[model samples]
Target: MDPFEYLEDLEDDRTKRFIESSNAQVEKRLGQKAKEVFPSLVEKLREERPIQLLVLGNTQAILYYGDETSLEISGRRIKMESRDHVIHSLERVWNSQLVRIGVGIRGSDEGYSLLIDPNGEVVGKIEGLVNQFFYQEGKLCYVKEYRREKSPDGVEPPVERIFCGDEMFPFYPGRGEWLSVTAEEKTTALLKGRGWSEATLYVGEWPELREEDSGKISSVHIVRGRVYYLKGNDVMMDGKRLFSSNHPVEDMKVNEKFVVLNVIKDYRSSLSAFTPSGEPLWEYRGEHVYSFDLMGEDVYALETSFTTSHSLLRIRDGKPYPLRVGRREEMEVKDVYVKGDVLLHGFLLTRGKPKGVIVYGYGGFSVPVLPFSSAIFQELVKRGYSVLVTNLRGGSENGEEWHRQGMLRNKLNVFRDFSTFLSLVKSLGGRTVAMGGSNGGLLVGATMNMYPDLVDCGIIGYPVLDMLKFHKFLAGMYWTFEYGNPEGDDRDFLLSYSPYHNLKEGLPPTFVYTGLNDDRVHPMHALKYTAKSRSLGNDVMLLVNLRSGHNASTPESRAEEMAYVMAFIEECVAHSSSSLHTFTIKK
Candidate 1:
């Protein structure tokens, strides 16, 4: 008997019925909301006619363009394409051209200004703009006096300083630059030069350093010519600590006279506003608060109800309008995007028969809904592969409740959820190809074992296959929230779903990929899983990269990985039979 057979046999009839009923309730509620919100979203995108969406990276910019059929990169049209396989990460975008900065594999690289011509045919590349590039009357101007330095190893470093007229300022790595006032004697002197007498010297750790460390900046605002920084729980203005706490500041934005701060502590969080002098203006406690946007004299915040619904709140004249945009009961927006009609939601299972499994839907973390704004997905979709993502309970899409449901002993729901999704897609006359990465990859493996008949083919990347041994590794210990501690009853639950222990004589075709330098999930997960699958006479292919880590380091490498997955899907769909012996695994 297989290890998974225990779970299949132990599933109680009553528990299965309850799970199905709960799933139906959620689907009815969310599916209705999606129907209402998506049509309006599509109309809005159509009216806005947003031709391009630009995303800034560390040293390069990604320009995304969408049409009726697909999403494509516009980098080539702008002449900002890199000859090297890896594109430079974009730091910021000002005027029309994308700005490239920061040190690369080569040391101390100079910042360059990249511009796509109006015709979209010619790209202009200007090097060494650190202190000399300026916007005069909304036009770009170059200062010739700025100097460039090359490291002893002959690598060009990113520009750190920029000269603005007679004054110089430090350029924050990913954020904008700060005014250089160190050469001036006093804060008043610096403010006086800028034609402001009462300007505060807004000081704190630089925004670039904060983004690199925490992955986000809580808040940034310019007041009286000084830039204030609110990072995590600390609020600082010109090196002065205005507020410090143990809480996590999730999001923030500035209005004319005050800076609004949203702080999250544990399960509950709140939103508040303060003056430049650290005086509190207003505060409200809530389960979750986000999407801080400023409009006129009133501050608008996009609020999410505890029930996974959404509404717009307007704060004006010190009063909060509870239903500014729509009634809480009537408004149910699951996922919001800048553009597009599809609103992705996730679910996790907690009380179901197959407890302890995680099912994630489309657009959970980095796994993404294939063919939905993902380059790899589009390529696969073009090849006639139907992709489906299961939002088992434990993903972020449906909020905290859904996530907690799929965690611990409830994790088996993830596998069950995937099985249901695959069955649904196949019923719709579409061949299914399942894919996942990291913890999600663990999900795909577990699903393949329990419902091998459902999944035709799978691509597992850097998966956590052996959940029993996962906590013994480095960052894997932190996953106690999802899988529970190995020493506890959760270990027994995890062992039930551990793909390494559950592999049997026959399984669907599968491909695994991992990086040698992956310090997070470790390469052993992929290696050991592949070895086990091969031992069971299953067709499993593994690809291990020598130099990459958790992320795809270069554009070419990303393209290659996508190509491999696409080819595998083509084979699975074309051949009809899910056989592994026909595929090859390369290192």
Candidate 2:
């Protein structure tokens, strides 16, 4: 059968009928059981709390919370930025869930770039994923990916565009490329690169955008009175080699006083700071929670590790001190280590002899999960399921080298690494189930196809399965460099590991999930894959929620999502745990 058979029929009435029937069957089977398990599970989830403070000023900030009080969006709990009087309140904006949207704060927070008032009102709106933003000369410039047209079938795969005030321009942009303004607020440096490999420098004067450059420079960073670019090993400051690093300049951050460059060598990372004239200032090599953010003249860093917890520290006078504090939950994680020849890292959360083993991992997109998000894993442990979280090759856990090792032609290594982890888990006995969402979902789906016995139940969400046609879908072309272009020379490679093309008749009990409003990965992926799986007489269930996009945004939606996951996990454990056994770890 053609793997792309269901592509055109996604919006057909027959497809809708099929999805409705699938939803009905799945609900009939698990609705009662879900009700029995989820209420208490939801209660237990309320115990875990996560709080975030987005700095707007020295004292003023946005306090978003995750707990009972913050049951929806990211829980925008407003705290007054004052030393004496304390006013804690939140604006009950019905659709007020904030996810990846970034808010840029100008001086005194007169009005935000998105026109979000201090009282939490989204007065103005913009279209697209705000990638890089800079505010200067009474104008805000941002680079984002947005579809040109606005229509029902407007899934045109967003192209990168630059929006400055009322004027806008389209520019081809790479992953790490960003928009930056010079310290003197004269020139704007735009870095255009593809997959962070080949960058063309474009330096123009403000909104005029009359960029004149040789186009050979890989990265462009404006600091103080000069513009710096990465050429070989030495840092080029205004056509002059100022300093050299031991390795390639992986990332660059600029401020008025300091130009910080991240050196990533063979999976290790270090941050080095330099003056505009290129005098070495300070170097730092340590594990931290999140990346540093630049606000006006200050570069603030948020420190959160398995040890120090979470706190926002300001880089003032060349030193970092606490600006705002964060709290860590009460749960503890024991027994963590690196594994495999590739140094794949993971931790196990075991409670007695676990009835079911949950293997969770995401090894794609160069993205790495930090210790700050162990709440869900902790909850999974509380439910008597031994949660094994693996950090595989595709992520930046070990820096850019690890990410490269899992991209394009080497993508199979990610699956192999994950499958190896699953093998190790299977040897531990108990009914094993694997969970992953988005690119992680692609990992689990591919693993299940290549090694079905590795997992008894597969929970795949908003995944890319039909690799041949994925690029035609929403924002898929943007990742062709990472996933390999199926329509190009990489076609054979993509087809080799494409999950949808390799599915067998005797698949495992699969619970395929998707959000109807998911404009990112396209819900048709889950729908068509589930349809194909069921046609082959595989035990498959399609679960979908209409209100979510990419993921469940609201607290209620997230709770429903958790309930479905718990229900599926419980069902799998009950049916398969009766036949589990213990075995020694494979060396």
Candidate 3:
């Protein structure tokens, strides 16, 4: 039933020729501009800034001090020499050992975690286990999933098992969907999924399975001899309900005395603290908390806003005291209401009156589009581009209810939300390029198909376009929760808005790119969509980078790819029609 299924064969001669030819055409169009911009972009990317990793003690912690190759612990610096791996996270085990979670630069490469002792010696390296592992006594407890053969119609779930040091399957029996596991000495807290919609909580060395307290669990942690978790909107401790929040709890961190929660509502994130007994401590709102870590009872965080870079802050007495101040750029952001009754929020960032507008959105997976500084966007703004970042539905921007309004059968609400912003930008009279990646790519792809007249061009990167067969690809099965399963009754709904399936001749100029090494969002989505769009006489450019993955590669490769993207944007805006295209505002 899939016409371009051959594109999935990454090693096929025909597939290689197809991608090579498409990439050649794209280079012929925008390669010169990209080449000119590459050097400056690389310089911008390599700019040194103090990146705070984690807080260890009062003054001691792990961080990158204006250097990319080395990490400083307190004052001691250790250089990582692995060309293929980078430190994704750091966890302190016991008092003398640290675990550095290293993820592969390429998406296809399964990375390993390193256990380093006090002498800076490499203690152990465990492959396929990163942050999921926990230190218990002197042993390491972790979970690993063994992927099964893909089904022709349905998505196959991976069989997961728990491994402790050298012992195989010592703790949990049988196979299940293990999401995450945390341990405190002998006690372990495990989260196992019951399909994509719900996850059950299991605690103790030999965790007893309980069906109750199992629905919609976001996170779990075992701290201070108690199992603490966030279920729905309420925080639960040892199966006892703590206080509930008006917004969805995005992330949670715990120490000995208190539990900290990062909650999102109204396009902003707030950090709140509560005691183990469910007593409210303090709440810090306004700025977005990019990340947070606890050292003893002290809370250190990286927080920022739309026009500011991330700043290091220490929270005490319910206040954020800046340890390192962030730099504020010249970019001015205006919060604009896009829908009727001022229901939806979108922020327009511009340095001055712009020549063109870039409308960016990612309205899925309960992920909010918060305000944050980006070097790339800042440069684009300086070049007379107005960027509009929207907090559409299907995200936790408004709350769980807001997310519910844009998922499953309500997925159309996400596209409708995006269309509203595009219409607003188009009404203001300028070229509007819709841009997004991953889930956001799906957003732009679907909206452009439905409302091609509203956008001048689109940039869809590593997208999921083939909704009907998405589950059969790598990691696509996990997204069935947000996007309904296409194999069953959900097929009709998925097919209706599926970007590749809905392609027509009137689409705007589109730039579709994917990493050849990307294991998360399959490259087939981009390739097939580009092939079909070009076949229909639409101007769709395709680029497949072999060295990179779902994430970024080396700064040089990243800058090169970004230069191409910028060139494409410039070209599209230059060719955009000057005629005004307006739509009636529902409000």
Candidate 4:
């Protein structure tokens, strides 16, 4: 019988039993050693750090520690803010009495936008449709991603609308999520189209995007009584092009009479300010900036070095100063440098030559690598494994050009970047376990599938393996512009790297895991992948944690998942008979 045939029957008795049996086999093989190491893994993950989530609406931040969340100022958490769904976007009225929040719901990429009063009550809601929103003063405008049956593509794109004093229209037919609305007599919005590649400056009502003033616009903002936007590399105020740059404008921030533009080319960044009329006020050019938050005209610059350490700086009037906040000791990477465009960052925690190595990557969805609150790296490093983290293309490491260079048909560039980083680690003499989760899982999966010699073992969590059936999953349609629509004429292109379809027998011992409650990725991915690997007589394990969503909801759940993977790694090293470290697991 085909073991993978059960994949068509998710949560069925046969499939459940099969998964249980496979897990039990792994347990028996690990035996006492697994019992001895699980706790330390959990304990290491249990260590608390200063976690803060900012509510830019009221300039208030919430600190999450242990099982508690506290207001940074008064040390009291507003009761009704906590929920089962993850907070995606949030804002509060200037009065501080009203709050608006967008939440990611279960089993779908679509979520709800809710309005909460100062009395800690959810007074109003638009459930399971609202994706993002923009607020100015007390007025609210939002963008919705809903299925419109009229769309020939089966997936209706997203559209922006005002709340009409009560709520925004959810079922409106449109496309685009990267948008910002201004609260004027005639509302205006900056709309980004199709994977946010093209931007438009628009002003309209109901369903139309006014494009008269939008000529290859990149971004838009309204400040004071004036309007500011970017068209290509030129900064435009009102309808006239003002400050033009030879390089691309990466980011823009406007407030009152001044606008600050972060422009860059070839991995170097320069920040410059302009008056409302576009007169250049000041400019500073330096090393690549990771990102900066505009805190009332003051800048909190986030910088990441080759070492796994972060330094926050505050910039005012082009002058930068060290920001002292909750910083302790720092870790140094001996050879702190960059080769070509790939950032080769390594940390060796053990004294002698490392026995195990982990090459970490997350190149998809344009998520950048940062050196902050990385529990995964901390746990692995403390376990005596050398780790290499790469800031490859396909991420916003060097901005949009870098992202575009690795997307669509050019996605092979991302895979190539990972191969280059892995080759760098191999020269240092260690067998690497290529690792990633979600989109990163796709990264490691595709690379390992194409170049099996690059890694000894692979770990993929909540991954999208079957790119062919990917669009059928939650919010999968939206990502088509990134990976290409698998059902179209380009289906063959996707088949070239869909990990499940490209898997070969005799690959490394792979750990494929996901959650039962994973609404984002279909649970059948890990199930089917593991089944096929087993059928091909490959060494693979499927780990499932119950009642968890993508990224896992709570710390205990995270620790449980981490302990299982760590235990599996220990077993793999033990079987190879090159055990360099050991840990105790509690009863």
Top candidate (lDDT): 3
Tens-place lDDT per residue, model 2, 1-587, is 66546543658787777778877887898888777766655553343232333333232233333332321222333322321111112211111222122322110101112434444444554543454555546665555555334222233435555666766654544422333323236666666555523345566665455444433355466655477776545677766777777654555666666677766533334567888668888766534434554566566665554433456666644566666654443443444443556655565656556788788888887676544444445556667777777778887666567778999999999998888778777765667788898888889889998999888899997788889988776667667868888888999999888878778899889898877766667777888788788789999988877555563244445556677777888887787634334433323
| Model 4, span 1-587: residue lDDT tens | 53465674665898788768866776676545555655655554444323333335334443333332222322334432453454444554322345565555332345566666544456677765553354543555555444332223343433334354465434333443344444333344545555645545665543444664654465566544356777756777767877776665777777765777877643446677778567778776644454555666676565443333345567788888865333232343332234545553333333334567677788766555644435555556666665666667787656567678778888888888888767665655556778888888888888988888877788888888888877765556657878888879769999999888888887888888787667667777788888887778888888766646673254556656676677766666545434333211111
**Where does model 2 exceed 4 Å of error?**
1-10, 36-113, 116-124, 127-141, 148-157, 170-184, 196-198, 207-221, 228-288, 294-341, 578-587
Estimate the overall C-alpha local distance difference test score of candidate 1. 0.46
lDDT of each: 0.46, 0.61, 0.74, 0.61
Query: Which number leads on TM-score?
Result: 3
TM-scores for all predictions: 0.46, 0.76, 0.90, 0.78
Ranking by lDDT: 3, 2, 4, 1
Return the TM-score for candidate 2, rounded to 2 decimals: 0.76
lDDT of 1 by residue, 1-587 (tens): 43322211114564344334433443343344333333333332222111112232211223221221111234333322432211233222233343332211111123454444323332445554332232433444332212224322332321134334444334322111122221111111111011111122333332222111121132444445455555435676655567754454655655457776766542344677777566887776654554544555566555543233344466675567864332122111122111111222332111212101112342222121211123443223233332233435555334334444566766776566666666544544444567788877887888888988777677798788887777655345545545766778777777888988888878878878776546556566776677668778998776655445563244334444455555555555666532221111111
TM-score of 4: 0.78
Candidate 3, residue 45: Cα displacement in angstroms equals 2.3
Per-residue lDDT for 332 in model 2?
39
Ten residues in sequence with the least summed lDDT for candidate 3: 146-155
Q: Which ten residues in a row have the lowest lDDT in candidate 2?
A: 103-112
lDDT of 4: 0.61
- Candidate 3 structure quality by residue, lDDT tens digits, 329-430: 788777777664237778778876677888999988777889886666877887888888988888877767787788889999889888888878777787
